[model samples]
Target: MLDLIASLLADKELDCRLDHPITEARAAFNRAIAEKKTGPIKRLLVEDAVLVTGTDSGVISGRDAQVEVWRADFAQAGRFVYVRTPRCVLPSEEEPIVTELGTWVGKPEKADGSEVRGDYTAKWREVEGKWKLEAEIFTTVKSRDALAL
Candidate 1:
């Protein structure tokens, strides 16, 4: 299903070349976050969707539960917003599911907090002609100092 989003990248030409339906759906979810709208974001997930956060590997399981988390984040006065940019999207030949690998960034609304960058993987399923997020796993890359033993 084509996402209800206008475009993921600022350049429409680039999006046309790179974006698949899954990427568009993912982009729509990101757009909803920027727009601070939970309703649109809710429709993008399956009932049993799961999310594994970056850094701590915290899990947010289930669609309603995840939506609630997003609701809380949006409710915050100066919370950071996470934006995901899909680098690769591969559909499974045997199933109606696709895997999306991407990079994400969390930019603070206020200038005080530092920006967070990470990599993420998302599993998407085509449910009744609509693409929905099944699960997403995140990994925050440690700094060179932090990585050193």
Candidate 2:
């Protein structure tokens, strides 16, 4: 009984420690997007990070390429808002890899006043004590009728 209690306490402590870094990473990402600061976004990504977006069909590989895409998007965008919430955060036991399944909503500064909602899975790696995004795959949420052939 004592062993079980101690194990449970240790697990809880581990969870607490994991939450801080994950939450901070997410907050930093949101801030970067909101402020339109590509530098902060690049700092959060690994050199060979992969980004697959719902807007485009092509996969963006490498941090420099990803930043270039964001630069173009940011240039065309005005008064935009992007928000994401993590639904699940899974930390790997064998490697320093963490995967987060989340929902993202974006409202572009457009005349149509449309909002884009999607689900994303982001893989992060702890590089030199800092969590950096390694890869991300996004899937847009569409209506049933839209999927109908």
What TM-score would each prediction reach against the true structure? Answer: 0.80, 0.77
lDDT by residue for model 2 over 46-117, one digit each (tens)? Answer: 999998876674699999998887788778745456777776577877999887767787876552456677
Runs of candidate 1 with Cα error greater than 4 angstroms are 1-17, 111-113, 142-149
lDDT of 1 by residue, 44-148 (tens): 999999999888899999999999999999899868888898876767778998878777888776645467777887899999999999999988863222223
Query: What is the TM-score of candidate 1?
Result: 0.80
How many clashes does the backbone of model 1 have?
Answer: 0
Model 2 CA RMSD to the hidden true structure, in angstroms: 7.8
- List ranges where model 2 is wrong by over 4 Å: 1-20, 77-80, 110-112, 143-149
Model 2 accuracy (lDDT, Cα)? 0.75
Q: How does residue 127 of candidate 2 score in lDDT?
A: 97
| TM-score attained by model 2 | 0.77
lDDT of every model, 2 decimals: 0.79, 0.75
